[model samples]
Target: MKPKTSALTIAAIAIVLSYLLILAIQQYPTIYRRHVDPNSETEKLPYQTYLATFLLFTFDELVKGNFTGTILKLKELNQTYVPTSLKYIFERFRQLLNELTLKLDDTDSQLDYAEHLIYSGREDDAINPLKVAGYNLAESNITYSQLKSSAEEFTKSFMLPRTQFFQKIDSIQNLIENMYIRLQALLERIEFQKNLEETYLEIQVYPENVWVGSTITVEGKLYTRTQPLTQKNVILYFDGQKISETRTSSNGLFNYTIKVPYTYKPKANIIAKYLPVEDDSNKYKPTTSNTVQISLLYITPKVEAKVLGKPLPGKHFTLEGKVYAERILPYNQIKVSWLTSSITTQLENGTFKLTLKVPETISDGKYILKAEAPPSKIFAPTSTTLYVNVQRIPINLTL
Candidate 1:
């Protein structure tokens, strides 16, 4: 049987719990400061110890104490019922991660919007806040079944639970979801602001660009985010492939070098990356450069041929020529031919000698004198064409 709660009873408990949660969150930071303070004495040490002891039980107890406090509240409220143990913590943690994933996704989208608005010179006209409000209403991560289960247990302990278990859980979960949504939105905005503040990309590499299988000097100039006067460290990567490494000078300057090597494969890629670090060398990040593509080619064989010439018809003539390869073939392996009116040649060894009978057709025209080699031989095809006025040449030929 379910009990009914009056408005007055519910309000008192909510106000008390809400106040406690807020106070706990507010005090946790001061508690953290005392412990982390290097120079603090006895008083600070005790507070630090106390805070440490509380967090020793759970990690979340350190961060705004949301998970620990929620667990404690549930334990106290359900004390009369058998408490769920180690198994329950795992279940809740899984559920928390699931809820957080949705929240983080929402945060990412909202951050994108905020970034666009801020950069677009529309700060005054930004609808981010309004849009977030609408988004919160549309998507609350809390489930009614979960709320009902919790509420039924909670209501069983109290005398008057006026609203149904489902409604009560819905209302409280709605409030929690709204706070989570708002927190996520705020964090995203803060990130956007941080990015805006450090807007310039102060990175330089000597020989600013490089070809694949080449090396270039790299230097960096970046202001430290936390330590302004001190220079930051820089690390670089090639698509996460470790490349060159170097540290920036104390004057906010860094220089180093890296090279891309040629691989036996047909193609390869080169990429640049920038990673910045502080005084703490162990703390570093690797950023990627735009990818560069490289390609290679193969070599071909070389060939050359040697050839000879001829004379006109009806002319007293003698001709001689030679055909040879720069790369000497051990055998007489070339084929040669003569073209013209009344032209003939004799091939012996690698040379040709010719005589012309001077036919009537041998006047004023062009003729192709040809010499060719077979496939088994390595010589390229060779030819020469001559324009001749055979009538002007009716009397003479030379060797």
Candidate 2:
């Protein structure tokens, strides 16, 4: 009886162990879903862990200067539903990142502006933009430090190791520092250049008004701070064309005589420029004198005429005259006209003599005679009038 009872006890113990093993196998899927499955609704990992992990990855991208990737990650994080406990941290991080982006963009924009101004030969104007960039960079540095500190604290709150995160922050900080140093150096160089002496060129032109083919004298001085700059080459430009080049004397005086070209315009501009070269290029800046305007005039011939002894009308009379001008007139004819008769004669050595016959039927009176020189390409038209005594053939019926 004792042996049979012991067997029954062993059999019951075996049956109980089998039932317990089957139950454990049946609950394996639920246990796995709760603790290990990432897609499970009831995940056991805290929400802060996921937030911290995502931030770490985003920071890694930023450290590599992958701004686009960092922005995408940030957008992804922002779109997700955040827990109430981590909402402030996420929002603060976003604000800090936005500020950092703005500051960096502003700094880059200002640097680009400075570069453009420098390339355009406005170095002095570039200084302002460079200064603005410097200010932005400084502010960016401060913001970056705040961002780094916030990230470190947020990660530390979750017991996350921050060695890698701190390294990324340090790298970004080093880049900013390098940029700042380079900008400061460039600013200092520009300021030094601004401190150099300024150069001035002054000019005076003689005989501001002249006819075509005439010469005018251009004189000027090149100096700095009232001190003369001798032996410098001065270039003279007339009507935007390079006409002549001259050198300054011991007293910084430069003189050039250039002939006025035949231009259709009534006025022409002349400018004197001094461009330093070789070693002197660094000592003085290039300068140009104030523009000098020259009045261009055509040669006007003066027609002087006289009637010999005031001849009577309707009779032959001699008209003598000369065409006086600054230049010799071309072999052109002069026209002499009376009330009813006209004659044309060539100018002989700028002088002309004409015989005119008054109308035989005219009454005795004082008449006018006119001599005119036609216009030419270089000479203007001119005319002269003289009064003549006209008598009707001295009619004397008694004689």
Give the alpha-carbon lDDT of every model.
Answer: 0.43, 0.76
lDDT of 1: 0.43
Compared with the true structure, model 2 gives a TM-score of 0.38
Candidate 1 segments exceeding 4 Å error: 1-138, 142-201, 206-214, 223-229, 235-246, 259-399
Off by over 4 Å in 2: 1-69, 157-159, 195-399
lDDT for model 2: 0.76
Candidate 2 lDDT, tens digit per residue, 95-155?
7876776676566677777754543235678888888888888898889988987886556
Q: Write the per-residue lDDT of candidate 1 for residues 128-176, one digit (tens) a residue.
A: 6536734543454443344345434333433223254334334445554
Clashes of each: 12, 4
RMSD of each: 33.4, 29.5
